[model samples]
Target: MSIFQIKQKTSGAVLWTGSAHDEKTALDAMAREAGYADYASLPDQIRAGGVQAAKLDLIS
Candidate 1:
């Protein structure tokens, strides 16, 4: 199922107020949304764990 989340932009730690099957999935969703469509290489982050806070909010 889908879920909602709030993540600290400097720590990569995520907080969710909805149901998810697991934490990895939750982090994945957060990174994808926060990173947006340019996240073409994002799912890769999940391969090693979620995105680092430094990688988020990039305007490029």
Candidate 2:
């Protein structure tokens, strides 16, 4: 597993930080952190410019 960090694209604010096994899990964590039911529930703007996720170094 690896740590993931989600941030706001525009403001560059850290939104969510956690460990996820895959991209899907990281995206799910990002969506939930933004208070949406799921990734599909997020608006286009939110998906495009509001938030983004990147895999960090692997967890020991």
Tens digits of per-residue lDDT, candidate 1, 1-60, equal: 544454544466663344445555555555565574433445554435534322223245
Evaluated against the true structure, the overall lDDT of model 1 is 0.47
lDDT of 2 by residue, 1-60 (tens): 888888888999887889989767888877887788888888887777867788887656
Question: For model 2, how many clashes?
Answer: 0
Displacement of residue 24 (Cα, Å) in model 2 is: 2.1
Backbone clashes in each candidate structure, one number apiece?
Answer: 0, 0
What number of backbone clashes does candidate 1 have, counting pairs of residues 3 or more apart or in separate chains? 0
Lowest summed lDDT across 10 adjacent residues in model 1 is found at: 50-59
Misplaced by over 4 Å in model 1 are 1-6, 9-18, 36-60
Off by over 4 Å in 2: 58-60
